[model samples]
Target chain A: MEIFDILLTASFWAAAVRIASPLIFATLGELICERAGVLNLGIEGIMVIGAFSGWMAVYLGAPLWAGVGVAMLAGMLFGLLHATLTVPFGLSQHVVGLGVTLLASAVAYFAYRLSLPEVTSPPKIVPFQPVEIPGLSQIPLIGPAFFNQTPLTYLAFVLIAVVSIVLYRTPLGLALRAAGENPASVEAQGLSVTAIRMGAVIVGSGLMAVGGAFLTMSAFSSFFFEMVNGRGWICIALVVFGAWRPGKAALGALLFAAFDALQVRLQQTPLGALVPYQVFLMVPYILSILALVLMSRRAEVPAALMVPFNKGER
Target chain B: MRLEPIPNPSALRSIGLPAGALVLTVIVASALALLAGANPFATLGLILKGAAGSKFALLETLNRATPLIFTGLAIAVAFRAKLWNIGAEAQLYAGAIVTALLGTGILPLPSALLIPVIALAAMLAGALILLGPVLLKTRLGVDEVVTTLLFNFIMLLFVSYLLEGPMKDPMGMGWPKSPALEKAARLPRIVDGLRLHWGFALALLSAVAVWVIQTRTTLGYEIRAVGLNAEAARFAGIPVGRVMVKTALLSGGLAALAGFSEVAGLKGNLTLDLSPGFGYTGIIVAMLALLNPLGVVVSAIFVAGVFVGADSMSRAAGVPTYIADILMATALLTMVLALKLTRTRIRWR
Candidate 1:
């Protein structure tokens, strides 16, 4: 089969959308947090907790949606840890973020081992199957790619649109942006910068946990150690590539997903047959670096990003 | 209550506060162990026994601490210059792959020459990997945190590929690992019949070397100046960018030594799971030391004890070994919080 013929298949697009959904959820979440001037290095840990909690809920016979709820709750608790450390205590953001990640991920692993220590194979759960919208999925490639997706994937798209609307067209979004840009100024308006920033972090973390839940509940059927992998880190990078915009971040997620799909497809081709499949795996990361190099020149980060907002001090 | 920062943070206070925090962290960790249906005292006893109860256990703990010291020092150096080299894991993996390749008979050299050459190659490969992030930050103002982190995933994938394809052990039963290094290229053991090796000595020596460089040299002063305030350092005629890049290179090079130590000192081979997140744990080590090079030695050993002890604890107590990780992370969090509290008085007015 020709390379173009292989690339143009509906299945490829469908796979791309499916693969990209987790990142979509995560990047959108990260974008919101970064836009509010908090760079959460705990994304990896939060994602791990999310994946673990979601898996645990399912393993305990809870429905998939309930698992997602548990994951979000876990993410919020972790986020609160971050906020308490970096905000009120005014400790280093990087250290607190790293600490939370280490703690959360270790706890996740411990819980998993404690719950299921003797499984020879990773215990599997009934993963969310893709919902085929009766009327919409009939439409060709677009339908299968967009309409025929898991409910989580559909939520991810809706989140993109909702986040876009919230960020660009709302007063609360304005407060978040101002808080990120100049917290002192936002505080001058009698709006508590700490509250706004903390809310952004918690909300963002919840979304990120949902993204993590999607991995165990919908994307894959089982939870393994380090199952979230580095998708959280990828989301962190995509936030920069997207320049803090939800739409752009979502698009970046898709671009990465496309690369992921292409790599898997490449493994089937004669060219890929000649090379180790890991070579294809390197493409997305290398591409992200290149993209960052090219785009970062013009990218504008939040002025207060990574800087802890001290309420009364300069 | 409001916190007021102390103008001059006392050394005793700094040390005392974090120590107290560590005690609290242990109490919290013990509570967690209790929640897990294990006797906290038994778990603690197992950890102590596993870590340093016997000579053999002590050697294993030392063996584990060696790599952490290298990576911790690597982090301390870069952090002193305010450069975030979060890609130490990638650098370590790169170095391990390079060191392994040199030992695989690919280079036609004498054993003595091959060992030194492999070390140099590892250092160079690790530095080169970090060169991108350093340059990006200095040139385009891109943040190194995300870039360095992203590179880690990329490098791990690269290492995974190498192990599966070019470096797969042929004689082994389909394990994705490189061929073991020549016996001549392996690090000599410091003690007979123990896993402890020359890497521990090297780690100790490097710590002293870093501490001396950090305190007793013009370059060290420059690095600290740049870290304290880059704008002031630049105004005071220091090349802030060059110092940042140089510090990053050194950090990467030292982190590479960790990979070398693991391969040459312990494993004698390269595998995908060569490091159980030692690179990231190094950050915790550095922070626990307050970014002090010499302090990294104690912190690395302490952290190593937690992990080593946890392993034995799990074996003996039927508790999950990850409690060690939880303990370390808790200590780190409390350490930073305690330090902050030390410098600030709570005003409950």
Candidate 2:
């Protein structure tokens, strides 16, 4: 059978969408942060904290969405730490973000060990299931792929519209974008650049946590170590690949996810027998680098990215 | 509030602020211990005892520190030039792969001669890995942080492929590990009958080497010039791009030496878990040391001691070992803040 035949299957597209859901949420989150002139490298560990706390909350008898809320709150708390240092304190975003990642990840592990001291295996919970839309489920392949997903997945799709609209059509969005591109201009307009950037990071981090919670609450039924597995970093690359635009970033997520899903399917075909599975796993990362190189020439990165802004100073 | 640079910071402000950061870290550590229902003082004591209270513990800490020193030096060298090479983890592994390949009965030489040849080869391999990302950054304007990070994932998968395929230890019972190094290829112990190897000695030598290079060379001046201001450095007739390329090779080679040392000196075989995020932790070490080459040695030992101490403390105290990681992260954050504060005064409007 031809390799292209795998792409025709409804199941393949379904897997692609399911995988893309988490990336969509995260890329959008990072997008928002970068749009506000802050690069939150804390995304990786924030996701881990989110995955653990969200699942831990659900395991302790909280409602599913409430578990997501717990995850978001946990992420925001870390985001607060990140913003306090990088935003107001005017510290290096790279160092502070890495520190937050380590701190958050360590907190998650410590919390996990303290919470469930006896469980040898990760306990399972009731994960989100496919909720089919009545009319769209009957359409062709795209319908089942896009419409019949968990509520979180649907929310992820909806957020792209929300973020794009708010970023483009709203005054708040203008100020936020101005903070990234020209903070002096933002300062001239009588808006607090720090507040805008901090709010963006905090809210954006909450969304990133939800993306992580999607992994445990929707993708898998249990939480485990390294389960997030650098997905957070991949989402960062997605932000660049999409040029920090919400709609384009989500598309980048989908494109990468499709390639990921394809690799999985490729591993089961005749080609699977010939090559090592590790090679296939390497493709997504290599492709991310390639995407960065391809789009970097035209990529409109936020001018004030990684630039610490101090009040009354350039 | 606004931060203004101080023309001359007093001695007390410099020392006191950094000391305050350490005190804050201790308080945080104690709080974490209390949360785990352990006696905070006892837990802290146990950590100290576990790290340096015994000769065995001290050696173990030194062993763990060997890799960190290399990676920390790697970061310090690159970061001093404002070149962010996050792929040190991958570069370290590249060095390890070279070590595994050359040391597994492939190279025919005396132990003394073979080690240097393998180290040089490993450094070259690691240097080449970083070269790609630096080139992409210089020419294509791709962000090296993301590209280097992406390279880490790619490199790990490549290592997994090798361990499971050509490098697989045939004598091992189906585990993914490389063949053991030949007796001639392994590093000799620093002292007879001691677990400590010559890698620790080599690390010290490298640190001093890096110190001399940074302080006494024209390349060093150019690196500092570029890091301070690229535009100014270019105007001063220093080749900014070429210096970055050279720095990349030096940094990547240093990071690769960690991998080489780990396989050839400590583990004697290459495995999937050769490093426990030594590359990432190196960032914390380098930052804590303020990117000083000599300071990297001190910070690497401190970071390694924390891990070793915390691991030992976990057995005695009800607290988890993650407290060490939290402490490290806290120290990194607080130290950077302290450093910033030392140079600048915060004034409230």
Candidate 3:
């Protein structure tokens, strides 16, 4: 139709892509972790840690890349703590993960408050700038949509591709998959199942942290309490919907992000104009339940998703 | 380390696991406190002083404990039936929504009648919220954890809608909260000026009621049996599905009481932040109590003391209130780990 109409549609899609980027990274990370037979329910907490660390890094003199680095490190530390609790200690994965989430949220809130003690107004940071590819910018709709995004968005797409290859195309991937499927069998073959799972957890947490950092450093510059909100849990649901596949999980994240973006855009529409905003806020959760119901039968989650592996067990 | 076969402990001895875990957690948590530039012993002293130091602080501690007792009992009852009810937070909100609706409405009744009716409405609201997951888990074989958790978000959104939409008071400025409940519908303060109200008594009474049902009643035995071993329980002619459904509903109802207490007893108005994660904290309480109803009261007060101490710690130590949250979480983590590590196996024929 008209140029303005085309621009509006493009802008909406762009916003959708931006919103979905962190989710895509986090879900893919969770997908890898789940495939390796660990349910990193601490994704929410790790994400919050990432959000805070990233914000702190940016608040200092660090660049956006530095913030991402710090976020990933923070995520790894959290993942290490979570893995130790559930893996060696054999504590309830759900309980430990939930605890981590609460602890991380508390840490983030306190850090934020400490950094901006005197300010009644919300603290702000400079968000990452979009980097446009030189030749790609010349293309029509595809150019703006794909090439013009923050570096993290580009990295997120690359990660999906990388994760897919690492999970299905390599010997390490095969061994990791086997470990998750039957730890006893893998252990008999002389592979350390605990080590493999711990590696997966750490890597997955790092990815989740990067996702959180993306939210703070790119999507939203300012950190608020509960900013990560329930996105981490949403990422867990995404892994289920994607059936623990990196590509599919990324798609699920994008779908959720698109719906979220549409909800925001629809707030300006006539139907949305009449409805209370909270109804739209419920869309992600409602869609998550619908996704679970529709996919439960077909979704082939890892057989030992939450089960603790004991080396001494036969 | 030498491999040795240690003597298997008696069941009575196994109960010491929680106590041992608490001591270990305190040690580890103390180390963390040192890293924060605070003395662990001093911090412990400060926490105790902050929680129980002043009359006002003690009253605040009781107020905090009031809702937690209900939530803890709610969690314990569900855990007894092997039902993991993570939606206590949502149920709490559901109860609060109903209490607000009924308490603010034009129901011409005496204060005595109005208050109990409003409380009952809250209980029903909370119970009704659990129906979906209970049905889904039993009928469709869906995981209650996912369904209950999802429903929590739905209920939260619903409450937000009510606060911003139909329940919004016209006389209020731009605050996103409902109109204050009628004076007749409010819970009477137990002591003249203290924030303590009849809800505290209700909390204590409910704790006793839960203990009676859990230990003395047949249903409680069935619930405990199902939790221990569902297949064996079913083989023993216990209605496992029915027990699950009932426990889930009861858990929601208990959690809802916390919401009722907040609205009618404390706030007299429904706000979005009515619960400061009371449902989640209830999980920690239930676990710490080892799922004992009476023990829930002790654990809840302990947890409430932490919250009160956290606020005071912020004021006294200049440490953020979140330090207390961190310490509490650390304690929970360590305690859970310790319990698992110290699991005493029983040799029985």
lDDT of 1 by residue, A93-156 (tens): 8778888888999989888888887887888899988899899998888888888999999999
Residue-pair clashes per candidate = 0, 0, 0
At residue B68, candidate 3 shows an lDDT of 95
lDDT of 1 by residue, B33-68 (tens): 887898888888889999999988988888999999
What are the per-residue Cα lDDT tens digits for candidate 2 across A29-99? Answer: 89999999999999999999999999999999999999999999999898888998999888988888889
The candidate scoring highest on DockQ is 2
Give the number of the best model, judged by lDDT: 2
Candidate 3 residue-wise lDDT at B241: 91
Error of 3 at B297 (Å): 0.7
Query: Which is the better candidate, 2 or 3, if ranked by lDDT?
Result: 2
lDDT of each: 0.87, 0.93, 0.83
Alpha-carbon deviation at A146 in model 1, angstroms: 0.3
For all predicted structures, in order, the TM-scores are 0.96, 0.99, 0.93
Regions of candidate 3 where Cα sits further than 4 Å from its true position? A1-8, B1-7, B10-43, B235-237, B344-349
* Model 2, TM vs. native: 0.99
Off by over 4 Å in 1: B8-16, B105-114, B347-349
Residue clash pairs of candidate 3: none
Question: How accurate locally is residue B273 in candidate 1, as Cα lDDT from 0 to 100?
Answer: 94
